[model samples]
Target: MKYTNPVVKGFYPDPSVCSANGKYYMVCSSFQYFPGVPLFESPDLVNWTQIGYVLTRENQVMLDKINSSGGVFAPTIRYNGGRFYMVTTNDTTRQNFYVYTDDIYGEWSDPVYVDQGGIDPSLFFEDGKTYFMSNGLDDEGRSGVIQCEINIETGEKLSKSICIWQGSGGRYLESPHMYKINGSYYLMAAEGGTEYGHMITYARADSVWGEFVGYAGNPVLTNRNKAPYLIQGIGHGDLIRDKNGDWHILCLGFRQIHMWMPYHNLGREVFLIPVKFSADGWFTAGRDGTAEYEYEIKGDFEQKEKKLYTFKNTSWKIDWCHLRRPDFDNYEFYDDSIVLHGSGITLDDADSPAFIALRQRDFEFELSVRLSVDGGEAGVTCYMCEDEHYDIALRKSPEGTEAVLKLNIGGIKHIENTVELSSDSAVLIVRGDNFRYNFYAASQGSEIYLGSGNTKYLTSEVSGGFTGVMLGLYSIGRNSASFSDFSCNYK
Candidate 1:
């Protein structure tokens, strides 16, 4: 059967996968989002479902005053001894920790901090012993892929961290995972940064530590020079063997918005690469180590895609999320609707505001929302961060509510367009394509066009963050508003 690449889409990067009880589970970097470390489940590698998040409670992770790209970095989800463990880095706190739960669907335990430094941490359990590895300096202050024995239950170091392999000559060597395949220890990692030159490399050794040699054809997988191809930055992958005994590498990759346009507002996504292991024990990924838009798997299972939501029910909150830790008392949910009490915060504030949004998954889609603001401003925004976002709001002007379009790029705010209204409520619409979005407002008898704004300006590349564009509902100032009829349709 044929399956799509990026089985998991939108800003979800640095994927790590493992199998338990015949089910495949995956996790990725969440970088400052309130519910940190998005988790997923799959029966086959190509099809995925968002099971939940690894960090829901504030105590499990830190995002207080954290920058857009500063919270949870790459996370690895592993299963051992009937317990599920997730190890990650809080880049903001600059700490590494692991959280575990015996019930996979239940809330995870509070973080068990590890003494190790650096990021992209992973845990490997073998023969009643657990080992931790991260891309940082060892106890001796030597930098490389460092490893140490640890007590899995307490996260206490049982041995001094030691430098392992330096990798096959690439900058920003990270995302290290160890495996014992065919009696040989294989260490895999990504290098060359997480941008255009990103690539995956591996080495093999008789044991977990030391004397690991690079594969003869180092950088076994990379799309760095595969320019004309839309898929780039294919690295930071995890390898897993399926029930059928087939090897597949689930990695992170991003597609340029257009054929030649070099901007991706959807963020780095997850892609599946087919793996082939040689009789001698070396494995190659992709088509000769290159990622593609699709791959033919060994099954005939039909793909069940995630549906575009109209958010007409109580479950809307499941897909909608707030910035930083949510201000629980700011809003209440009823079937198909929400009442948001305006806060002193605005989208311009670098802190959490009265906002709830969903990831902009597709490049071309239409988003519509109906809002009635009692005071201040309320509307939908294509948000990247505090200093970089595009907002279309209904404000209570002296002439009644006004439909206004705001463009904030790199901290410069501009009122691109506005149409004063004589009503208390209005329907705001946003039709977005890969590069820009067209805004419209409809009321009693008049239809107002609020002009268009470029989408590229809100990308991670231009915005200098670790997230993608988010379509959100926001109300600012000290008032309250009712928002309903939210819908998103993909083209």
Candidate 2:
């Protein structure tokens, strides 16, 4: 079985993967979010398992006031010798750092700061030497790709940097990767500002540093034509070869409507494509710039269903994460349900008190939650940004058993409907197309439609964020709430 685009859906971008010890480990940028840098493990390149995160402690960074796109940027994962290394840029601090671990599942070393004033640091080890490449603005105020050697032990630059390729087309370029294949060094990077003209380009050189030649087929892979949009704006990719010498490219792309431009979703999602090397030593993704049905792999291992979210056996999946750093004191898991205590701030606050959310993908989807509220305002919400959201809450009102459905469109709050419920537990169902939302509520075996409209209010256009949409359960005020049977289905 072959999966074409979006092997992992919804806001999974800037993928970097490295194979080691008969297994593959991958990581991606989780900007402005907590439990930073999702780590995925895979036996075969097609199937993946979410292992854990790189940043699990508060000491990692101060994210209290981190804005939508002001946290972590692009991250590159590489295996050097016996240690697995991850280098990332903290946009807030404008610093690049490196973290490594001997065992993939073991504790990773604290970030060793590299004083490189650039983003998207990729490490390449060749012939007992390590080289670091990044995208930075040069002396002419022209941002170009650069490469330099670094001391592996201490994250320090050992040589003066050299500019290889200053982007093609008149747009900003970033996300650079250096790989040595058959004695020739190849540099792959993204260009065209990651929007409509976003593309992946390559340049080749005889030496690690020097005159690199950009490919005549500059954008080796892109969706610049009309017709089937299986993948759009595909770039920021990393390439790897299996044991049998078959190559694969893991990149990020987005699915968007015509009104949303090309790459205007929350962020990029993961896409896999087969790769072929030309007789001229150049690599191109897929066949003729399109994805393939199936690719070749060397391994002969039996396929298995990878578990994503069973707390005991598998703690968390790469798909499961919060929008920002979560306050552990606000929530806990018990009796197969996640109980959230009310926080002082409402969902409107940039730093909302308690929210456990997952990325929203697909046009038609359903999210159901069985919630029990005791006091103040507490319930489940489908949020797009800080200002735009829709919630079905069980609140304490003058009426007996008060239930309210509220919509915050562009910072303006509108109560769509309110019903009085006599039951303790209520099942809230939120269904939506890409633009509109329908809210439903059920209690005591009775169901009612709460609200239905073009809730475009809950979109990136109305709300301001670097992400698309998120569905999570939240509680606020002075009391607490319990949420069970939390399920999400996407069609």
Candidate 3:
């Protein structure tokens, strides 16, 4: 079967995976989103279903007024001794923590904080001892991938943090994961940032505390210079062995809108690449050390792609996320509909507005929703951050209800188009392609064209954030809005 590059899609960046109990479970970074770490389970590596979130309870993590890419950073999920532990860093608070659960389906326990200063934390268990690792400064103030032995029960440091492997001469050396394979301690980390220059570099040592040796041909996997390719930013990978005992790397990458555009609006997504170990115990990844758009693999199950998503098919708890910490009083959820109570909070601020969103999975999609607003404004938004979003809403004015289209790019806010609606309820539609999104309003069996916005404006390249575009249903300004028949069909 031939599987696509991004087995998981849409804003789910910095992926880490571990196999347990005959199944593969994965976690990804969720910056500034309420449910911090998005968790997914897969029967095979290619097909993944989001099971739940790792940070469900408010007490486990903090996101109040955090910047767009501020909260929960890269998360590493590991399974050991009948328990699952997810270790991550809250970049907003500059603290590292881990949450554990014996039952993966059940709610996770409260966080146990580690007095470590770094992001993208990972835990390794060996010889009845737990070793915590992150990319930061050691006790001697040496900058590199740091390691320390810790008490897993209490997160108390049992040994001084020490620098292990520095890297292979790339900038932003981060996302370090320690693996002991074939009795060799292998440390993998990403470098050259998480952008176009991203690459995965590694080194192996005889002991965990190395004297490590960098691979002669470093950057085991990357698509940095594979220009004019849709897949970009290929780094921050976690190694996994499949049911057939073949090794693969589950990493994060983004699809550019165009080959030469160098702009990506769909956020960093998950990609699976084949890895092979040499006779001397060194490994190389992808096709000739680069990730591809698709790969043919030997698997028992077929690779499937989800093309249509609706309220009935998607789980509200697993598929939907809101900005920062949301006020529960602002939202009312039903089986087929959602009612949002608009508050004074708006999308322009860092505060949590009445917004619930799903990640935009692909470049071509048609999003439509039937919305009815009683007083203020409610609509569907293509949201990237506080400053970058496109909204098509039904607002109540003194004259009547009007359909409004707004494009917000950085400091510029423009109402591109509007239509006088005959009724309070209308279907808002947003049709998107690789280049742009077109807005429309439908009422009385007629579709009115609102306007369009360029997709480049909403990309992380232009928006300057670590997230991708989200299709959000939102309301604002002390009103009651009911949304129904919402669907996003991707082609």
Candidate 4:
């Protein structure tokens, strides 16, 4: 059957997967935003459901005022002996840690800090012993794909950290995973800085220790050289075999709005690439080892359609996200309405704001929300980070309530357009396409088109962050606001 690329969309990067009881569980890198790592479950290699995140407790993951792209990095999820383990790096504190859970539907345990200093840490369990791997410095002060035997229960190092492979000689040698295949240890990693030149390389050794030989056809997988391709930045993959013993790789890649433009605001997403292993005990991924828009898989998995979640029937916990540490005490969620209290902190500050957002899963969509504010301002926004966002806000001006279009680029604020509202309430509409997002306001039986902002200015290449655009409802100042009948949809 034909399946699409980017099995998971929108800012879910550093793809990692592990199987348990014939079910596949996956995780992706979530930087700075609260609820660190977004989690998913798949019956086959395709259709995935957002179950929950690995780091949800305040003590498990740290994200207190850390700037965008400063929190959790690459996360690796592995299941063994009826227990699930997730290891990752808290880039904000430069700390490496792991958390475990016995129940797939429950909260994870407190972090077990590893002594290693690195990013993109992964766990490999072998014959009652656990191994920890990451792309960082080793005991010899050598930096590469480092490994060490670790006591999983105590986070204690049972062996010296060893530098297994230095990559295929590319910049940013990160996101390493180790696997034992046919009595040989194989190490796979990503390089090329995760941009246009990103790729995946591998090496194998007889033992799990040093002197590993690089694969002759090194970059076993990459789309760096593929032109006119909709998807690029293909690398940082994890291998998993399904119930039928068919091998598959879950990797990270991005989609540009246009073939001519390299910029992408949807952020790095998860892509599924099928793996083929020969009798020679070697594996190749994707067709011709490059990513594409669609793929043929070995399973009879049917595609899961995305449901349109109108606010009247939205799943608040599963979809909405809050910035920094959540001030949940100041908000309430209901079936038909959301009551949010504004803080003195503006959206311009990295501090906590009264905001809850949904990941922008589609490049083109329509979002409309009816908002009523008592004193200050309340509306919607296309939020990238604190410094880069486009707002269509309804603020209480000296001349009564007014609709305003404010654009914040690189910490510089610009008020592009404003119009007085005949009433204190209005319906704010944000229509987004590949190029720009246009705003509209409707009140007192009439509608007015606000302004539009370029999408390129809010992308990672220009905004300097690890996140994509998040469409959210927010309130600033001490006004208590009520928002209802919110609807965001794509056909």
Mark the regions of model 3 whose C-alpha exceeds 4 Å error after superposition.
none
Task: State residue 473's C-alpha deviation in candidate 4, in Å.
Answer: 1.3
Q: Determine the C-alpha RMSD for candidate 1 after optimal superposition of all C-alphas.
A: 1.3
Give all TM-scores, in the order shown.
0.98, 0.91, 0.99, 0.98
List the RMSD of every prediction in angstroms: 1.3, 3.0, 0.7, 1.2
Native-to-model Cα distance after best TM-score fit, residue 137 in candidate 2, in Å: 2.2
lDDT (Cα, 0-100) at 170 in candidate 2 = 35
Clash pairs (backbone) in predicted model 4: none
Clashes of 4: 0
Writing each residue's lDDT as its tens digit, candidate 1 over 1-491 gives 89887787787899999999889999988886778887888888888878778888998987877677888999999999899999999998989999998877778999999999989999999999999999999989888899999998799999999999999989999999999999999999999988889999999999988579999987988999897878888899999999889998888888888878777788889888899999999888888779998888887698776646776632543466778877879887777788888888788876788888888887889888888999988899999888899999988888778899999999999999989887899989999998898999989967789988888898867987668888888989888889888888877
**Candidate 3, 1-491: lDDT as tens digits:** 88877899899999999999999999999999988899999988999999999999889999998889999999999998999999999999999999999999999999999988888899999999999999999999999999999999999999999999899999999999989999999999999999999999999999988888999878999998897898999999999999888999999999999988999999999999999999999999998899998887777678888998899898889999999999989999998899999999989889899999999999999999999999889999999999999999999988899999999999589999888989989999999999999999999999999999999999989999899999999999989999999899999
Q: Report every candidate's CA lDDT.
A: 0.87, 0.74, 0.93, 0.87
- Number of clashing residue pairs, candidate 1: 0
Each model's total of backbone clashes: 0, 1, 0, 0
Off by over 4 Å in 4: none
lDDT, candidate 2, 1-491, per-residue tens: 44545676666778999999998889988777777888888877777767888876657755666666667888999997899999999888788888889988867888887656678889989889988878995434546887778898898888767676775653667889988889898888888765546678888889877577888887887765624553566778898887678888888876664444332334467777888898978877876875443455455654444323322332333445665667778778664577788878788876746777776666577778788877878787777666777888888876656778998877788899999888766988888775567888899898889987564555444554545666767889887798877767666
Two-way lDDT contest, 3 vs 4, winner? 3
Model 2 poorest ten-residue lDDT run? 306-315
* Global CA lDDT computed for model 1: 0.87
Model 3 pairs in collision? none
Off by over 4 Å in 1: 313-317
